[model samples]
Target: MTVTVADCERVQTSWFQLRSQVLGSGSWEDDGLTWANGDLMFPRVIDPAALARGVERARSEGASIVGAWLGLDVDPRPLAAAGFKKGWAPWWMAGPIDLGLPADPRVELRKDAPGADGRPPRAWFAAARQGGQAAGGAWAHLVDDLAGVFDVEVPEPFQRRGLGTGLMQAVCAAAASAGARQVVLNSTPAGYALYRRCGLQRIGTGITWWLHLPS
Candidate 1:
């Protein structure tokens, strides 16, 4: 199945909502913008009007810094007019899980189990271990048939050792095991090639806007 940019955005929003719930933060929508307050304040905007409202809301909430995810179709002139600067541009990627990718023998994959309290897990985490030490990790949130992958990281010391591919493969395996039809993630420049090797394609480019509000 082909995933469009809209699908990618919806999956991204779902990931943010799941993160907010897990962190005990708040997520809401107002004036066509989706807002989330967590380690960082994020307002997903679709247009200039919503962008303006998000800026005001962030400032009123005393947010020292606000980040906005804008689809590539969004006009940048408005963001510049509002004093928001361009942040990193990440590719929105989605694809079927390539279970054929070979997992690194040195990296053992672990998935989070249900807590002792027995509350069903809202999100699944996949961590890669090398010689019983933490090598890399990532999180996957399932919303219906779509799974959103977040924070796929491999430390500098762990780089160039295929830990990232192992993590991606592990994530895909977990998502597939949980019945997800597709996996999606925003890929940074550094991780772009790895994700491609894992079978994801760049469906769209997403813009992240940043603004520092007065204290």
Candidate 2:
């Protein structure tokens, strides 16, 4: 079968539409967060100009900017031109429910929470011991299917280690196990190539348009 650009756009559009239905409407939200399927109208990181417009629009409609989103468009140029922040303000990775796979050697994969089997894990990790002395190794979490990813820190001293890959691998593996027909993520410029390495195809891209409260 073949797919067209319009098909892709529909998929993108519907994804956000679904998010809005399940979570909350992308209308004027007095609380500061609005949703449209998976497309976040408001997320965490705010874009000053567009955000101002968004807030105005929301306020005019009796809503407020409770949250903000950073746009992730297919064209990085537009985002750059808009001076939008490039990061995971929303969008996250998801896949098959129970990808019962091991967490490759030199790392360990385990359930993120106790009896989290049916609850859908927000995140998982492939951890390495902190040198028989320190605290946490490295970790990443699934912020649910609505938001793609939150953050991953390997620690300053832990840089250069292959730990990040292992952790991601483990997470993907679990997502696969969880019955996720596809693994999804709005990868950063740095991790974009890595997502390819891990077997995820670009399904759709989103833009975060936002307005923030004054500091």
Candidate 3:
């Protein structure tokens, strides 16, 4: 299915909800979303100048700045020219629900992994070795057909063992079971290459900029 602007909005709403739970101590308004704990702000469909203004405002308030843009068209040159450090952000990947990525038999799938307030996982997936020596994890909150894969990670020792792919497959399955027709995820710069191997296509790229502050 082709992703549209409205689809992006729906997925983004779900993302903000998931991040608010995961990031903790964050605020969301009509203008944008902010995670106070991470000092991150995600402005909605704003231009480079507006984004720069927000960064400047945050810096003036004694907060180090981290900013994110949702789609591929993002350009951080304005922020960099304004003095913020520019760096690569995660790539947004999406594909049909059945990515054909296999789930490793050695990875145990768990439904009750720890979550906010020790409550039952609203939506979570974990893949771990029997002895717990290696593990991979991913999370999401499904909104209709869009399964926003919030985050995925595997430890250094577990790298290249296909555990990361298993974790992704596991999460995609979970989302499908929960009624998702499509899967979406933000791939870390490192995981971007890893995820592409699973038949998922990079649909768009997001930009992030950071400014360090003196303690």
Backbone clash numbers for all candidates listed: 0, 42, 0
Q: Once superposed on the true structure, which residue ranges of model 1 sit more than 4 Å away at CA? A: 38-53, 56-62, 102-122
Which candidate ranks first by TM-score, i.e. highest? 1
Listed in order, each prediction's TM-score against the native is 0.82, 0.47, 0.71
Number of the candidate with higher TM-score, 2 or 3 = 3
As for model 3, its CA RMSD to the true structure in angstroms is 4.5
Q: Mind giving the per-residue lDDT tens digits that candidate 1 earns over 1-215? A: 77877777777777877666666655767666677762122334356776677667667756688777776666667668777789998788999855478666755555566767985554677777776788888887777778888899888887888888877777777777777888888988888898888888998887887777877
- Candidate 2 vs candidate 3, lDDT winner: 3
lDDT for 124 in candidate 1 is 72
Candidate 1 residue-pair clash tally: 0
User: Could you say which candidate leads in lDDT?
Assistant: 1
Candidate 1 overall lDDT versus native: 0.74
Worst 10 residues of 3 by lDDT: 30-39
Q: How do these models rank on lDDT, best leading?
A: 1, 3, 2
lDDT of candidates 1 onward, in order: 0.74, 0.44, 0.63
